[model samples]
Target: MRHHIVHAGWLTAALAVLGGVFALYVHPDFLVTLVDQIWSCF
Candidate 1:
């Protein structure tokens, strides 16, 4: 039972982080800037 709780907590945190990142991509301006920065690395 304790192990299951710990796993759930980690899963929830991962999902939250992914949700936040997805929210950021919803903006065209942010997406463009992110792509520009990544492309610059090459």
Candidate 2:
């Protein structure tokens, strides 16, 4: 039971992170800035 609870907690955190990333991609301004920053690194 304890193990299952820990697993569920990790899964919830992972989903939250993935959802946040998806939200970022959906925003065009963030996408453009991210690309610009990566290009600058090169």
Candidate topping TM-score: 2
Candidate 1 lDDT over 1-42, as tens digits, reads 999999999999999999988888787798889899999999
For candidate 1, the lDDT comes to: 0.93
Deviation (Å) of 41 in candidate 1: 22
Q: Runs in model 1 with CA error above 4 Å?
A: 28-42
Estimate, for each residue in 1-42, the C-alpha lDDT of model 2 and write its tens digit: 999999999999999999999999789799899899999999
Instruction: State every prediction's TM-score relative to the real structure.
Output: 0.64, 0.67
Alpha carbon lDDT at 31, candidate 1: 80
Question: Relative to the true structure, how large is the alpha-carbon lDDT of every model?
Answer: 0.93, 0.95
